[model samples]
Target: MLTDTLRKVDNLMKNKFTAILVALCFCITSVNFTGLLTVSAATYGDYTYKVSNGEVTITGFDDSVSGAITIPAEINGYPVTAIDKDAFYGCDSLESIEIPNSVKIIGEGAFRYCYALTSVTISNGVTTIGEEAFEECSSLENIQIPDSVTSIGQWAFYNTAYYDDETNWADGVLYIGNHLIKADRD
Candidate 1:
């Protein structure tokens, strides 16, 4: 009878130990997955970005940055495919910027109110330039729109020196490459 009780106790202890080990492993695995999600949210230089479906989108920038900046084609091994609205808005000190070939879209007002922006280079992979993308870039005098761009939103270059310059117009129209920008109805 004593041997029988001892066997029962040993069996109970083994079962409890196994259950505890499995619960502990589950907790550890849960914590590890949570940590991976947090780690995925990262930054590239002064650019705030997010990754989704294996693509990266630049969402914002450091307001204090000055001079020229080149948006990297990839951030943290993910391709930078888009720029969010207002990403560089109010960057008064920015002089120039280059959008890499991996980017496909430029969100609305991406560079709005950048008073000191003078030059912009858009690579060939871009497909769309959003509304008010370069609005109020008062000092922007040089910009290039590649053939890959399929659309430009309303008021994209409003108030920009490039748009205001008379020499940039041909006949009664302003054009960037082969894309018709505006018409001088006057």
Candidate 2:
């Protein structure tokens, strides 16, 4: 009878040990998977302002920023294709900007309300400037829209100050390679 009892006890202990080991392993696996999910959420959640050729598209600007900003020529190794509407709106201290040739389009209000912007150099590959692209850029003293662009949207420079003096402008008529855009409104 004693031997029989001993055998039963051993069997029970073996089963209990196996159950504990499995439970510990399951707990560890759960913790590992949870940690991985947390890392992934954090990485994808933070603010990443950019637009790329295939992966991401920038739509607009959400906050005000000061100082000059040099938008990266590429994002995630893909060339930047578009500048969305209001992309640099309310950036009061933005003094100058260089739009790279890789950018094909500039959306509406892209530089609106940039009060301190004094110069802009649009590269030769851009094709379109959307409506009100530079609206209210009061301090924008000089702008050179390249010859490659074919379309300038309505009111692109509405409510903004432009070259009142010869030194502030290259010509009385804003010319994109002999295609006159406008005459300074008296």
Clashes of each: 0, 0
Predicted candidate 2 versus true structure: per-residue lDDT over 1-186, tens digit per residue: 999999999999999999999999999876744422321111112223443224233454434555555554665555666777887778777888888888788889888888888888888788998888888888876778888889988778665566344443454555445445566544
Best by TM-score: 1
Q: How well does each candidate superpose onto the true structure, as a TM-score?
A: 0.76, 0.62
Model 1 agreement with the true structure over 1-186: per-residue lDDT tens digits: 999999999999999999999999999877745423432456789999988777888989997999999999998778999999999999999999999999999999999999999999999999999999999999999999999999999888888998888888789788878887777724
* Residue runs of model 2 more than 4 Å from their true location after superposition: 1-56, 61-64, 163-177, 183-186
Q: Which consecutive 10 residues in model 2 have the weakest lDDT in total?
A: 38-47
Mind sharing the TM-score for model 2? 0.62
Q: What is the lDDT of every predicted structure here?
A: 0.90, 0.68
The candidate maximizing lDDT is 1
